[model samples]
Target: MINGVTQLEILDFSHNRISNDGAIALAKLISWHKSLQELKLCNNYIGSLGIEGISFALARSPALAHLDLRLNSYVGDEGGIFLCSALSQNTKLKSLFLAACGLGSKAGKFVGEMFKVNSTLLEMDLSNNDLTEESGELLNQGLIKNFKLQKLDLRMTNVSQAWEFAINEQLARNIANSTRNNINSNSQPNMKTIEES
Candidate 1:
């Protein structure tokens, strides 16, 4: 079924010009392969319908960790919404790349909502999208509650200068907090050393 491989872990079909039908077929394949950990469908022509199929497949994939959907510009805000909804249920996903996927402010809001509850996602790239100041604010709201997210890329988006400033401030605060905690832990005397003394 999969070139003598029963349990596939990673599938990379990027730059293949695969459209809706191909995406649907891939989705079906993924549904049967639960061992899939990473899926890359970048630089394709998949649209909203295709993304819907993928989203449905993702809902059933418990082992999927990394997903790269970059440069699929046909999947607009609606597709982003569907994908984000699926991601909310996927607890194993750690890194998500959605750059240049025609996402807009509405999609940004959906991403924010996903981040609010998703505990496993560590890295996300949303660069070169249509996100604006309002979207940045919504993202900020989610960032305020999400401490598990370690990296977020928003380059070439429509995020405002003010929002960037706020984000930088928040990052600085988090770094300072972590540094202080590390310093405090290091300053504590070791129990073994104290006993010897």
Candidate 2:
């Protein structure tokens, strides 16, 4: 059922004992399937090598959009760097879920850098990860630089009060800006419609 299926649209192998080898096997299959969109391998034993394989595979995949690798134990700061590097070139991906993936300050720094340049990314879920204050600060700076991101989830990651306050302010400003834009857009009516009315 699995090995014979080459055109799978979604594959979820989360909470399994599969190691890097298994992850690599799945990643390799991406080359054969162009229809694969959402892939979830969360809570697996796949570590750095597996992540690298996936990163490499994503480099060539144009149809893949949403990827969920939450709770994977092998992805540290270095793996994060590689993943973000791959994401930099992948413009088709809109949503990325990497919650509780053991991201440290180093990884978070790279993630922050990724956000600074990747404008195609709309939503990112990094909740329950081990991101520290330093990483949070870096991400805050990254957020300030990039305006294309719509939502960023950092729930239960030990974010400091100061950082929380700052992020709150940023969210408030974002809401105000969005509201202003909507009001301005709605205020303008079609001249033809007005005349006809």
Candidate 3:
């Protein structure tokens, strides 16, 4: 399971009764840990400044696989933008969980931009935000050239039905393309096996 990343291999800080300042300070430590791969800060009441601190710290790392920040309702669009900007250049993260973090329509453009260049991220959860149809389309547009992301959850948002469907369809297409590519790459038989045959 994914725990709130505290820059340890798997440090879970969810519902730990940690103070906001303390959490922010701990989050800032992410910049120094090269082996740290996952961070989760779910339901921590972290504000935008805390998020900015964490984002800045996280941006310095070359790779991290998972980050869960669910239920930090105060990390609004500003926080989202900070995190997305930090993540845009990272290509090693595979899953991100941001459910109920209050990322509204304003964060959509940056989130979409992240999708455009990130080739390793595979899943994301943005449920319960007040995102609109336009935001959904922006995200979809970013996915047009991306074939790495396979799952995107937008539940409880205000995205229109049509746009939601389109986004899902695009995700499905990406999954299919990735699967096909993987199969094709692996289908090449080993030369030694061919010689034995």
- Which is the winner by TM-score between candidate 1 and candidate 3? 3
Give the winner by lDDT: 1 or 3: 1
Ranking by TM-score: 3, 1, 2
- lDDT tens digits by residue: candidate 3, 66-168: 8888999988999999889888866667888889988999898899998888888899999999888889899989988788899999988888888889888
Off by over 4 Å in 2: 1-7, 168-197
Candidate 2: pairs in clash: 47-74
lDDT for model 1 comes to: 0.85
Q: Write the per-residue lDDT of candidate 2 for residues 1-197, one digit (tens) a residue.
A: 56577677888888887878988888877645677888888888778888899889887775777888888857877778888898777777778888877778888888888877876777788888888888789888877866666677888777787886776566566567768999999999989999999
TM values, all candidates = 0.83, 0.80, 0.88
**TM-score computed on alpha carbons, candidate 1:** 0.83
140-195 per-residue lDDT for model 1 (tens digits): 88878776676788898899878867765655665676678889999999999999
lDDT of each: 0.85, 0.79, 0.82
lDDT of 2: 0.79
Error of 2 at 180 (Å): 7.9
Model 2, C-alpha of 193: deviation from truth (Å): 12
On lDDT, the stronger of 2 and 3 is 3
